[model samples]
Target: MSADSKESSVRLIITGRVQGVWYRAWFMEKAINLALSGWIRNLNDGSVEAVVSGLRENVEEMKKTSWSGPPLAKVDNIDVGIYKEKIVNSGFRQLPTK
Candidate 1:
């Protein structure tokens, strides 16, 4: 949230053995560590969905690490999209399944 730095946000739909493998928890931890803001949740479709917003460089780092996820997760694919808005007053959290 600074004038000099560009904000970057992304919607990540992670698939393949992501749910039930601590992905959301891991995501929360990683996002916080990166000083990013957003939320992560489980989708009924068996994929994990997350929205991350922060510094452009931080967002890029998140994308690089999130592809691998936690050790137990078998990440087959990640559907990445440009997220336009930041979640209001929200920090990184693990949301209930949607």
Candidate 2:
């Protein structure tokens, strides 16, 4: 399969009022709905981090939707980068804070 046709993964570091607003849960729900596989967690720096893996289109959509997180979250910025590693989990999950 062509590279573009395969699943893609990205590591997103979302900042600005992301924590404490149920961002992780919201993200998990979105991932599940998108039929994605990966994990979401909260960092100690008040930012939310997630590794999303899925079809290229789905991954792109997730990246866009991340900017407008949960209703209570005031998302300032999202740092997105290609995640080279594979996602072992078969389904999306919400992990403990780091």
Candidate 3:
């Protein structure tokens, strides 16, 4: 889809052994490579939380990839919420661990 036609953002909470397994770094790489913009961080509850904003297809791709996570991550579940949001120029980033 054209960049201008894309309009969606997804907040994802991934559970399991996601923290301390390079999940953030791996997600950053994937997002950047897909030309997606968003932020990812570790939660105090041992889950990895992320917000991906971009084209609908790209955001969906990100969610799909997140389900597997890094090889070291044992993803047990992924909870997602979709919302309408304006697209921004921000690049992918790994936020401070919580």
Candidate 4:
């Protein structure tokens, strides 16, 4: 699909109290529930990064959910950007820190 379409991809870099709070697991659960295809991982900069691709509505929902992360997370900011790469996977996963 084209990048301009609604069914696209987004990379989210979420900061603040995100680490050590099961944020990646939470994100994985939500993304899988939404039937999204992508992966989430912890970054070296104490942030959580995720690449989510699916229906625009589901992806948007995931973005909104990222703000409230797992109750223990205090999300300060989420830098959302378009991700041009396509996801070859079929389910959500938690990748190793990068």
lDDT of each: 0.88, 0.89, 0.84, 0.90
lDDT by residue for model 2 (12-64), tens: 99999988888888889998999989998889898988999988899999999
Taking all chains together, each candidate's TM-score versus the true structure is: 0.89, 0.92, 0.87, 0.93
lDDT of 1 by residue, 6-68 (tens): 887789999999988898999899999999999999999999999999889999999989888
Error of 2 at 87 (Å): 1.0
How many backbone overlaps does candidate 1 show?
0
What's the number of clashes in each of the models?
0, 0, 0, 0
Prediction RMSDs, each to the true structure: 2.4, 1.5, 3.0, 1.2
Q: What's model 2's TM-score?
A: 0.92
Ranking by TM-score: 4, 2, 1, 3
Taking all chains together, the TM-score of candidate 1 against the true structure is 0.89
Full-model lDDT, candidate 4: 0.90
Q: Model 1, which residues run further than 4 Å from truth?
A: 1-5
Which is superior by lDDT, 2 or 4? Answer: 4
lDDT of 3 by residue, 57-92 (tens): 988888888888788888999999964465475898
Which residue ranges in model 4 land beyond 4 Å of their true spot?
none
Colliding pairs, model 3: none
- Candidate 4 local lDDT, 1-98, one digit each (tens): 76577697899999999999888888898899999999999999999889999999999999999999888899999999989886885888888999
